[model samples]
Target: MRLKSRLLPLAVSLPLAGTLAVALPLAAMLHAAAQPPPAGAAPEENAEEPGLAYSVSLPETGDSALDDAISRASALEQLRERAPVDAFGLVSRALAEANNMRDALRSEGYYNGSSRVTVDGAPADTPGLADRLAARGASDQPVPVVITVEKGPQYTLAPVLLRTDPPGFPLGAMGETGLAEGQPARAQPILDAQGRINQALRDAGHPFAELGRRVIADHDTRKLEVTFLVTPGPRALFARPGVTGEERTRSELLARMVQPLEGQVFSQERIEKTRQDLLSLGVFGTVRARAGDRLDEEGRLPMTFTVVERPLHAVGFGAAYETRYGPTVSAYWEHRNLFGGAERLRLEAEVNRLGTTGDTSDTGGKIGASLRTPWFLGRNQTLTFDIAALRERPDAYDRDAFTLGALLERTWSPRLSYGFGPQIEFSRVTQDGVTTDYQLLGLLGQLRWADVDNPLNPSRGTRASLLVNPIYSMGESNVFTRLRAQGSTYFDMLGDKGSILAVRGVVGSIVGASYGGVPPDKRFYSGGGGSVRGYTYQSIGPRTAINEPAGGLSLVEGSIELRQRVSGPWGLAAFVDAGSVTEDPTPDFDNVKVGAGLGLRYLTGIGPIRADIAVPLNKERGDSAFGVYIGIGQAF
Candidate 1:
């Protein structure tokens, strides 16, 4: 009986003991791999680890991982200095990292080795006693570390293919996009945009689109061929039972928003766009759209919108803090539908506290809104009109101004828009009363070209815009006239790598000098984030005889930037800028105030959050000490 009792317990206990016993060696191995060497001992540096805590030293001391957290692109010099704990699986992971890195750099058109490690001081072989000791106490030796980098293989876009389902697909709409044939198709954004095109086609009532792609490579030629295969199912129809969320949108508007065609091919684009259009009303809490063959035969997809309307149209407020602009707050009231039918109207008040001017006129603001008709002329067009009023006083001009204006806008297509109207202007004297008071009639024209399917971060494509405004005064001593032109361009340097380059230019002047005076507000003022980065608003314009840079008429401004993607929806940029304001129509180019700066971007829902600090190469009296800008979207 005693022997039996002992054996039973021993059997159970022995298994437990074995488990713990075996675990110790395994634990030891892992511990030794990641354990750091103690101070004051020569040791062999081991490979790097992903989770291992590390310290990096760059060519420039400011380079560090913490800096990378807020940066758009990572710095290679800084990346080279990271030191990971020496441990198990370290060498193997390092060896197998090639594929992982290839994927990461492929987006940037640089599909090369993303990392390189070197031991500059760690001896290839430690001294006899040190080696023996390190094997036992790897934690007790402090090892010297050094590394170098070799940037590797680069690839370019090779081709794209188009695939269709059901074997026989209609290619009429494609109309020589050339995408059907293989072309040098580089950049993920472009690829994504192509996806959007497919989606748009589907949305256009072609619901049968099947989006797929294939890649072919030629090793000898170092070329890649990519083909997109599309399978478009049978045409679908709008056989609706009823519409939900009618309370959120007027029944009439909701009805207009619905396009149920019989025998029309279903498209993913149309479904999503209808959803977006619904949300654009700003009346809904949430809007969802789905289209598939779930409700029909022959894979016929029907469009349905599930919507959640806002509970209330009441007051809402928001506030934000930034390094450059201390704090800002804005409040607004909106009605999702003023008189029903998904029409929208909103009113807002705002205040801002800037670092230099405290809370002055620049901080105070007001706005008004109205309805936007999506199909003013046709499905591809839209029309909108708004009226707004504002009052404010700023420190720079020691001025306060109040005015009301009305504007009417029309969009011929999604890519093109234009607007014009009239304004009654009046202002309190502040800057020598050089030009003030007028009933102004303004003419405005605008044009834009943007191919990116996504608005938040356009990976690949180009966007260009131009705006011209000419204002003429009706009642005045002398008939005053002003002409202004602004142009901007967005380019994806390499597209999918999250890299971008942007440029903008502005030129304005008083044309056909009028006997009537021009309002100070109507006159062009430079500086701040939009004009000169390092100067305050109105402090960067044409200089007077005393070399002052506050007042002027004709002005020229421009900026260029190179953006790089870092990690996880972040980016970094380096830029150069130049501009000048001239009293005369023709200003001296060499005499302009030029500056350069770096910027950081966070891709947010609304747009990219931008922060930039600029320093001017040429500085004069009353110039800004340093330029700090915080805002949404690009400065241009």
Candidate 2:
């Protein structure tokens, strides 16, 4: 994290001469002490001496303001480690420490403050102290150290002046330059003022503006005067952007990603946005965007974008475990720049329900491949094609399925996007020992909006999505539509460091079809880690005569969570989820099943590793006592 310094005005009126008299004795004591050895090393002979024990204290002054400043400036408070082998070492260290304390006072505008150090109840200058300590090395007693300080009257600014090359520049527009007359005269404020002025000029189109002079201090009159001489270079406009370091990704594609327009007023913000856009593409390992130091003949600033390409091919594996479903394992291979133009291709395989109390026929698996291309006919759009084969044996049905689909997605802004797609599928499904074959074709549309601060672990903002699918059975005379909508919102109850409240809701329905007419795999079920939890997967809806789940035509689910950071990289969460699946076209709220749970989060650079344990509030005979889930990222 970056540290920022601020200029705070000091309010005090005291005589500097009086405070100096009190500090003069302490300064004399420090001056008489011998120079200490370099830090982290001890003299060979003195190494035998035990480490010295010491304490630092500041006696209260009648003035509360000076006392507070002294406390803040004390060296003892800032030292990470403190140990001295002998009296000589202690006095030497104390002498160096006194100088640091004095500098701290000056930073607070106390140019005439005084400080002193004492060891073993006596001033450091006491004669024969080193010899006495050498004789008492065998003793177990610890040495005591003390520091005294007297901060004199703070200084005030006098007749501050800031001049730039351009005439009639508005210096007042720069807030808190820290150089106004009668304000505290401190080093930090003056330095901060210079930086603020330089930045202001750069933001106003003077990219080359810089400080040209120094500050002058007048101690005799207890006043300071500072001058900010600056060079405000000529304003410039942006020229066409240039790109380099391209191997697979096309140069034209990169050029189009730069948002700044030619001949527009040059801006630092615009340049930064262009850099971010390139990074979002994910094909570049590193990206740099900078404006030329020299202007072109047309008086336009030429900008260049240099990037390093990342490796195009990669393979990885993933796994997830649940108490109810056992474990699922997956692997994938990807080519990020397939055929250039920033296209992507990926192939994946996954197996589920390992180590469960069931035969191989009860297990499930999927194999799939997908391809995506950027700038599909327009800017900020993508076209994707996917094909997959799957086998599953859930309580409601057993099935072998094949699907092919294509989607066109468009991003309107950073926070909003929409997609439409067409899909076809063929399936062989079995229910209650009876088998049936079906073929279906569908068109799907979706809209989504998210303004969350962090995609992995959001502490603020809202996210919402809507999906609609209209389907026609090719083998049978049947038609139906499925619509689902989900929304979630997050709030930081105490800002970044405080707890977060996250709430989510989902609702869906299948229209124009009865339970027997729709595919079992496409029907809604409200159980498992991503649904009502606590209950077994697909176990919360209508049930057959044999107690197996019968999938429903409608769904309703909601969840609420309170997440708190317990310590560094560790967090705790408590949540409640409730939902129901109904055979009716509309949800039946009376049969809702509720689950409550607790979760743990370990924060990582990419996201959080999460584990959750849940128990059903309305447990049925077939429901397990508890369910455990482990995965990466939040459940939502």
Candidate 3:
């Protein structure tokens, strides 16, 4: 029923009766003949040797939008005093601008508009104008040139006409093009209507559908009548796609990826979707899709996918610094197409606390390797295997651990995804001068939804993630479930003014285990640059008899920031963060810690370079006066 209502019968007649094409040529003639050049002369380009210098004047034209459009369309205003010209040359330049101004006015629905360019109150055809300017001869004083426009009453669209090359087409196709009669007759909307009609035709299974060449505008009735000549080419179904330009990746794998799209009705949206899917494999730097100009013998449209592969291998390194945490360095080596099939293998290492106030033994490091195979089960699915060895010496605990995990990730849509897997870990941790060894087996599940505009520096939209990991400690003979959820939302407070409001919140808990029974590293701790800035790492939670940090079973954290762009590539943020760590499984606010900070952000090609300084509002005796943090992205 919906389809029947949306589309007319295939035999619907499209006609162009009672239509007159009369006004566009006259407007064109007026603009073309606004200020014709003298006999046998042409406009000259700006030369190093100055001839005549002139200033341009473009006053407000009553309508702000028209004023802006005219100003932007004026070449005289853009060239300004930098381009010197003689009297004839100036007249030529001004004359050329009349067409541009006329087009600008027509774009805003003023079909009967006109423009005039004058030099020192004299028109271009004024007698002796060239001699007068030649006499000035590059003087210091700028010659005055002015542009004026007279925009007649705005025009509305008359009943628009539709014509099909084959004489009969769907009459309902025009409903969605926003080309209804009585609307303003702006040139852009009329052009855009044609584009929309073409896309609609393509969506309706005509792969080669396009606009025809008959756009007529009549200004006699102060109305525009657009004649959209639709050419609905042969409708076709999708055929097998051919792949090319692959050096290492298996062609069979790419073909299998597109198998689901074969035999469907030809639609541009599906073609683009397949193109993006191929690019998401990560091995391809570019992917292009082309539909055959002619159908095959089976009446299906053939498709071709061409991919340009990225470098097979790459290596990179980076470093970051914070006041107390000191400098951290990291490096990675990656093989994007390892063993082909778009498999990715990466090995990375990181070292932190290069020079801190603590002993040299307090430095921490990690070494890890991961491999990801896309299309593990099918399209939009991936399988990943990871192994890592890490050491950490934070204020709450000291740890040495080795972990192994295998995950299956699936993407349900552009903004939603989920992953689940099993993990194994072996670790020796020391806390409060007591050492303990544990072997843990865990199952982890994660779900994420992100619709933000930018991953590194988002200006709008919201993103959220939830993680649930259930672990059994073989040494302790206990099982615990860890649950954490975090979300952030950004608001563009002043459009085009570069103001944003970003808010974030996190809540986490450990159940089925006591606070002391859980691994210290897995337990929640608040403070430091990433948590409650201005306080030392893990210093805001419960403390032992000697005031050393004791990790908590529950956590609650939040941050709010107002980001304002002061100028191009430079921005500032003022933020407040608050958090609490509780011994009980349920979070409590009794010991909440709050920190306030100001940050400077320098936008870069990769992301923003961030530097922030904060002071604790509820500072205790040992908290620092202020803390400084630096990194390559917005602090979560």
TM-score of each: 0.58, 0.79, 0.90
* Order of models, best lDDT first: 3, 2, 1
Query: Which stretches of model 2 miss by more than 4 angstroms?
Result: 1-51, 58-77, 80-86, 102-117, 123-142, 147-164, 170-201, 211-231, 259-261, 431-436, 475-479, 491-501, 511-517, 564-571, 584-588
State residue 567's C-alpha deviation in candidate 3, in Å: 3.5
Q: Compute the lDDT of residue 428 as modeled in candidate 1.
A: 51
Candidate closer to the true structure by TM-score (higher is better), 2 or 3? 3
Candidate 2 lDDT over residue span 27-109, tens digit each: 22122121232345433225566655556666465556445555555544333144445567666555566655555565656
Steric clash pairs (candidate 2): none
How do the residues 18-124 of candidate 1 rate in per-residue lDDT, one tens digit apiece?
11211011111112122322322212245442322223222222324212221212222222234343432223223333332233333333322243332224332
- Per-residue lDDT tens digits of candidate 3, residues 572-603? 99999999998899988998999999999999
Give the candidate number with the greatest lDDT: 3
Q: Candidate 3 at 538: error in angstroms?
A: 2.8
RMSD of each: 14.4, 6.7, 6.1
Q: Which candidate is the best by TM-score?
A: 3
Q: How many pairs of residues collide in each model?
A: 35, 0, 0
Q: What lDDT does candidate 3 reach at residue 629? A: 89
Residue 377 C-alpha lDDT in model 1: 40
Off by over 4 Å in 3: 1-42, 46-48, 173-175, 213-220
190 Cα displacement, candidate 3 (Å): 2.1
What is the Å distance of residue 333 in model 2 from its true position?
0.5
